[model samples]
Target: MSYDRVRAVDEDVADALTGERERQNDTLAMIASENHVSEAVLEAQGSELTNKYAEGYPGERYYGGCEYADDVEELAIERAKELWGAEHVNVQPHSGSSANMGVYFSVLEPGDKILSLDLTHGGHLSHGHSVNFAGKLYDVTHYEVDPETGRLDYEALARQAEEVEPDMIVSGFSAYPRTVDWEAIQEAADAVGAYHMADIAHITGLVAAGEHPSPVGVADFVTGSTHKTIRAGRGGIIMCDEEHADAVDTAVFPGAQGGPLMHNVAGKAVGFGEALDPEFKEYAAQVVTNAEVLGETLEEHGFSLVSGGTDTHLVLADLRESHPDVTGGEAEEALEEVGIVLNGNTVPGETRSAFNPSGIRAGTPALTTRGFEEAEMREVGDLIARVIDNLGDEEVYAEVAADVQELCDDHPLYE
Candidate 1:
């Protein structure tokens, strides 16, 4: 029997899956941290490797019948290393956060001083957000982007590093939409004799395709999520200098997690292979183009953009001055009514709570991957602006929803 036919035997399960798929087909995913993987990646993820219990590295396995597993794991590591120009790559960490934890655990003592970017300024929670393991376990110093320029305050970071003399300095973010200067960050890290770690989770594909700066050779450690811009399956990878390979490997396995997920690793291998294609480079370039168009269009529409605009695939819009009456939460709901999906984010010095912030973070990666271009992005921006302008009007929302469906149908994703 076919898998779908067998699944159809359970009526409620089939209904649930069908309904969820319909939800995906209807909504536009503008979340920067999300993307739709190729069906090839999905197929590899559901392959027979799902039943494996490979606990050790390639060529030295803990289980029998490990030849193919060895080959797949080795290929993932080699491809990842070459893609990023890293001396060593450990593709075992389960998530970006997990990869982050591995780095901290591998290098620092429990209370060692660590410096990282602040969360409100586009840093991740795992980068010492006070609630995560990094903040709780390490002595953390945070730096923010300049309020006036809405960019990294590298001078302030340098001062903090010199003052604190931290053991490590982490440079990466979850909402930053500008380019990162590894040289400046490396200087700060060097000033303090710190190990520099750059998490390119949001821009791994961009870096792989030369759309963004590479931190592989510059930083002591680099980490990323495969599923985001990399278009890989859901997992994380950590790359480092060859000298730290064993430490990183131990950190990922015994220090942070147990057995690796072989199925996901297989999917990652497939993703890495796809990322090597020349077309992926074009895709990466288009991501930036679409973001530029959307940002320029929104600014022209009188919306206030954080950093004045974007240099990357994301655009963070300030809703306070643009649409003061509508909070980020309300705007999110309004856009959702129009089949546009995005996340509310905290603006710099935001007065509102996190649940209903003063900003919205949207991106073009998924749309660009679906073959949308600058023209479509302009239309998308217009639709988004209109939705924000008419957030409280149910009639406008219903009408916009129809238009969104038409637009999506005209340029169907994953077709």
Candidate 2:
């Protein structure tokens, strides 16, 4: 992992890279959108493929020296097809948001209506946030989770869809911690003569392992990020039926982006191959089990979890009831001081602003990737509660940091 060659050319950038690697190894990564990739996948991402420009799909590139690129991409597409069972797949979008953009360009017209979850309620910026291009280009409407239950009320959403009559209904989320009923959402879209684009960016790995229900056959189009729960390198993927194949391909290449990140496609190929192993399914199942343990442990410490608990790999703890004076940002800072890294996020029916919301969101993907299980997560949850409960106490911070360091040593990442 030494960046010796980089150090010879530029010392500052090399130091930062070394520091980041050390940091990951030493701390807990609880961010739900993050995961640790295998060294095989990392090598592929940093491969010579990045230097080559494969401007088109496999076997149909605009440039020469694409033989290897074609091989990597074809392998990636084939493995992805086997993983998700999509009729057509595109592995070229640079990110999950770009994957959504590819679908929008392929099927949606400017000013066409888009119905999606509210951003503060667990949706993404690409799903028509006002600051994002999707919002400016389309007419956007949003649905929220039930304030009392802290879960999606599909019946209310269906009514909202009928009233709006959007051209496309976008399902999937970034923060909500429950199983999405893709069929139910699809039925609403069908009732309004609209298409469904399920962006399963957060749950790609779960769906691949059959731990979570897939949206591939249910939604008209499905999108995901390769890096999140999936051990793939950073990139995006789109899956659709054969009917929309050509349109998606054209939209991805000449429409939203220019050249394919061939390096990432190679990484995806490698990671997808690893995920096909039987052990990956066990890993996925443990991820959910670990989250359950984490949420239960937090609840025992008097923290209130949104939806009462979770069905996914993450849990959202609303601090409004348990620690009224401690904002999510304060808890986040205190946790980080003790080497536990997670994000403060908006809760449903938030009373605070987004910048410093009323809740903390933590996940088990990176920990599970590091081989952590129920016991370790329960310990980690206790440490988090201690740090939040004693925010300004130096003694408590030091004790928690020591406990966190011992756990990190036991799990040992990137070794």
For every model shown, what is its TM-score relative to the native structure?
A: 0.97, 0.99
Weakest lDDT window of 10 consecutive positions for candidate 1: 1-10
Taking all chains together, the TM-score of candidate 2 against the true structure is: 0.99
lDDT of 1 by residue, 1-415 (tens): 1248647588778777777667767788899888888889989998899998888889877788888988899999989977888889988888999998888888899999988888887889999878888889999988888999899988889998999899999998899999999989999898879999999999999999999999989999999999888898999999998899899989888889988899899999999999998899999999999999999988888899999988888999998898888888988888987899998998887889889999999988888877789888998999899989877888888888898897778766655
The CA lDDT of each predicted structure is: 0.88, 0.95
Question: Taking the tens digit of each residue's C-alpha lDDT, what string does model 2 give over 194-274?
Answer: 999999999999999998999999999999999888999889999999999999999998999999999999999999999
- Measured with C-alpha atoms, the lDDT of residue 221 in candidate 2 is 98
Candidate 2 clash figure, as a count = 0
Winner by TM-score: 2
Tell me, by lDDT, which candidate is best: 2
- At residue 162, candidate 2 shows an lDDT of 95
